[model samples]
Target: MLRTVSYHPVVRALAAHGLHTTVDVSRTYPQRRFTDERDRQYAIAAVRALFGDPAGREENGRFHCLHYESRPESR
Candidate 1:
């Protein structure tokens, strides 16, 4: 079980201040260890809420990754 604070909105606020922001989220355990699909979805949603859409996603045998970057021009 993972819990995230509502500070996700701060990412945009930092970008508004002309600061570049990057976030990387990776699973701590193997995919098979996460037996609950809802947990996977929740993790994805939490990261998305904090950083907006992911710039990239990758999954290998070991773990999954979600990458996010906020560029001033993109915003």
Candidate 2:
């Protein structure tokens, strides 16, 4: 069985800083109310293609997932 994973708020906070969010992976890592299977898969593939290793996990009442980091100077 899959164990529940913790959601690191810092991860979401950082993703937000760059206009990105963990929600981007709904397809590959489906959870209640977050997204449907199709979207999740699309998101997963999209992320993998872009970031090489996209994060996908669950915690609390929500699902946490991978996010890309912005360049130092971009922020």
TM-score of 2: 0.29
Which segments of model 1 are wrong by more than 4 Å? 1-3, 27-75
lDDT of each: 0.47, 0.42
Which residues of candidate 2, in runs, are more than 4 Å off?
A: 1-33, 57-75
Kindly list the per-residue Cα lDDT of model 1 for residues 1-75, writing each as its tens digit: 122234447777976789677665553222333346665566556646655432333112122433456777654
TM-score of each: 0.30, 0.29
**Which pairs of residues have clashing backbones in candidate 2?**
26-40, 27-39, 27-40, 27-41, 28-40, 28-41, 55-66
How would you encode candidate 2's per-residue C-alpha lDDT over 1-75 as one tens digit per residue? 111332346556665666442333434333454366665565455544544343534322233333333333343
Q: Count the clashes in each prediction.
A: 0, 7
Per-residue lDDT of 71 in model 1 = 70
